[model samples]
Target: MDRISALRNVEDALRAFEEGDVDLTEAERRVAATLRTYASELDGEDDVFRAVGDPAVDGRVVVAASAPAARERVLAAAGIDPDRIDDEGDVPEFDVERV
Candidate 1:
């Protein structure tokens, strides 16, 4: 499947798990597949999508350091415009002033 489709599937699986509707094994399988596909689509040599402890609705892949910078990096790595990743609703947002 395409990267977007894989991402959506991963998100859905995580949502199901978070809501207590899916099991750990199923979630893991979906996450692993999604990560693999995501990594394959990475055009940047240093791009990496490391999984944090868990997934959430606002975000699935948590950028490892400096949330704002990481957010931009994540967007860039995913071929998305850095200006498009929404952070208004997420806690510890992508706001540079708060970083």
Candidate 2:
């Protein structure tokens, strides 16, 4: 499937899981499979950026360099205050392997 379609599937599965319509295992499996396919499609790009957000809230993910400014930009784009990202232990859930 295309990246957009695959992501949509992931989001759907996540929503279902969140609403208790699906089990966590099934939801994770669907997301993993879709992400694997999508990642393969992006095979030759520079993977030098990362963005963090709760998929249960936002379905889209974006990447940015690890530079302080870039990280702040990404956090802001996700509707999170960069200064508060590390404060109050509000770390956003993200997969390190995917990053």
Global local distance difference test of model 1: 0.57
Assess each prediction's global lDDT (C-alpha) against the native: 0.57, 0.61
The digit string of per-residue lDDT tens for model 2 on 24-73 reads 99999989888766754554433434444456223333443344544555
Candidate 1 lDDT, tens digit per residue, 7-59? Answer: 79889999999999989998998888777666556553334334233232224
Q: Estimate each model's TM-score.
A: 0.35, 0.40
**Runs in model 2 lying further than 4 Å from the true structure:** 43-99
Candidate 1 differs from the real structure by a C-alpha RMSD in angstroms, to one decimal, of 10.3
Worst 10-residue stretch by lDDT in candidate 2? 56-65
lDDT of 2 at 73: 50
**Once superposed on the true structure, which residue ranges of model 1 sit more than 4 Å away at CA?**
1-8, 45-99
